[model samples]
Target: MLLQETAGSDETLSLMQLDLDDFKPVNDTLGHPAGDKLLQFAARRIQDCLTSDDRAYRLAGDEFTVISRGSGHPAKAHRLAEALVAAFKKPFTIDGIAVFVGTSIGISTAPPDGTNPEQLMKASDLALYAAKQDGRGRAKAFDAAMLELLEQRELLRRSLRMALDQQQFFVEYQPLAEGSRIVGFEALLRWHHPLLGKIPPAAFIPMAEADGMMPDIGAWVLEQACREAMKWPENYIVAVNVSAAEFLTSGLTDRISQTLDLVGLPPERLELEITESVLLERTVNNIDTLNTLNVLGIRISLDDFGTEYSSLSYLKTFPFDTIKIDKYFITDLETDPKSQTIVRCVVNLAHGLDMQVTAEGVETPAQAEWLHSVGCDRLQGYLVSRPLPVEAIGEFIDRAETSVSHALV
Candidate 1:
């Protein structure tokens, strides 16, 4: 009705859609009652930010919508969105607990954007998705580009369902080396779309996680990697990256155990690599799951170390077999004294904790020599070799082993 009225009137109106960021952790950590109070507080704060002509409504589950009428429709809508984001920045005290939350908003002006409710809401929703994708606590206005991206994403989502069935996804193995010797291989997921050529993991992995397709995809990768590793030297291990969604999926441990048994790969020969984000919520369950895998003789690695602020705290909480220093710190290690200092400190710290350190993105001989000199346990990246197809692994391993033996001689 509001959109219809605006369409008939000479004046224009804007619709703004908003979603609260990091709200799920609140519900998971705090009781839902507390979450309710937080939501109420957020609603009041949002209403407070709006002008007299604007109205706010709770759409569903931390999602909100606002209708703004009068002059400068979208401009006023953008201002309201910014104000709302700023409003949430201040902490809300729920039951004497200080809780922090942020919001992402999308805006679409009527007539120019749409004359009907469905079109305007969809435009605003698309804008909202863009805001969230840009890292939350921001606002995005409806644009043709966003619409095109949305269409592309939808097509990709549909294609992803058929991808695994059609065997379009495959795993590539990147060597992880200890000094001159190759210690193991890290399995990297790759996708080759029939029509889209090759799609980067960054483009589709998040979409899979969002659509709840990661568990199946992750399971397939695990089985394939384990089977391939069975063909490698008995002492060599295979490390597979696990997404947070896959890590938290129920029966994940059992699935892995079954896969290892079916593939006739020893649990000790498989390593599961996960980022700090996987332990962000459900810490107890995640710890139990990790412990179960550990009991099965599987190694758990903390990947992309130092990327998150809470990396140190996580180390204290969980006993990770290895920590892979992020590539960001390695890019300028030779030239940057700070990078050298940080890498050295991380290597020392990991060793002190009885955890091995793997330096990723080791692209040059100098970097590898420096990492070796600093007592880094493993090196992975272009310096060792780019990720390889399964058929290439045997030849690469033989060459690497021969090179290591010659160096030792």
Candidate 2:
């Protein structure tokens, strides 16, 4: 209908595809009945943003499409997208529960975007992909450059699939120091592509997660890290990051147990680092997995704390062995009084909970001193050491241990 209407008129059609961000959590936590009510409320809210001439259609689960026809199509579409996004910032009351859900909008205009329905939809999808990738709770307009980016992403995805099979991936260990003493090392994944050279974890990790390859890649990391850590002193721990996808996978506890048994690594010497996002969906599954891992004596550390919503609430909900304060707080610790206050409060709270506190991104002696004074149990960042391959860590650990022994004398 939009294509037909635009065929005869000079006026263009603005195609906007909107997706509700993090909707699964509502269903998982509140129940699907609540999710249905939330969707109904969201649909009404979206309709309120559109003019009477514009029409909104439910495209699929948690997805809505709006077509607006006008002379100034792109301008009107931009305004509508912004309005929709802003409106969702407020909580929607469903079944007496206040549910918070944000929106990601992808806009494609007629003619330049596409003349037919299929082309416009595809273009809008590409734009929507970019919007979500850029980070959720945002709006983006379709452009030619996005197509090029999609192509590059596709190539990278293909290469990533073959990466594990070809053994192109490796792990880099960054030491987590307890004051001047080396207590543990965090396993960070690194990929050296045959053609793209070295690809950082930030670039490839998410791609792996999205491609449904994290479970395989993550298992490899766990097995390899534990196997290597077995060679280290029995007192030292090896922390491995667990992606939300990998955490949600079935048999995670069994995998970890198998790894420990195979490598003869003590369960106390292994730590699994997870983020708050992992708790957003599948609450029951996450808790059960954590409980099983807890039983296995593998320590669980809440990574990048104080960066997401309800940091304190997470501590109350789960039995985390440690809380690693996010780097953002540390960067502003000296300049911002609020950062200092927050760090102090978190340290106190973690101690109160009997959980160890690890401060990340500590880059200066002054910063290290301040965190130590505030009762931070462990520190990790460039100030101590950059991530090194397994071969270099033997000497690194020797130097770290020697330095700490000297400090004690």
Best by lDDT: 1
Model 2, range 1-409, lDDT digits (tens) per residue? Answer: 6666676456688899999998987786678888898889999999899897689999889999999886687988998899999999999988777778999999999877888788889999999988998998999999999999889888999999999999999999998889779998999999999998998788788889988999999999999999889878889999999999999889989888988899899898999999988988777888899988898899999999877655466788798999999999999788899999999999999999999999999887778889878889998998888898999998987788776534322
TM-scores of all predicted structures: 0.86, 0.92
- TM-score result, candidate 2: 0.92
Q: How far does residue 220 in candidate 2 sit from its true spot (Å)?
A: 1.0
Backbone clashes, candidate 1? 0
Model 2 steric clash pairs: none
Worst 10 residues of 1 by lDDT: 400-409
Model 2 lDDT on a 0 to 1 scale: 0.88
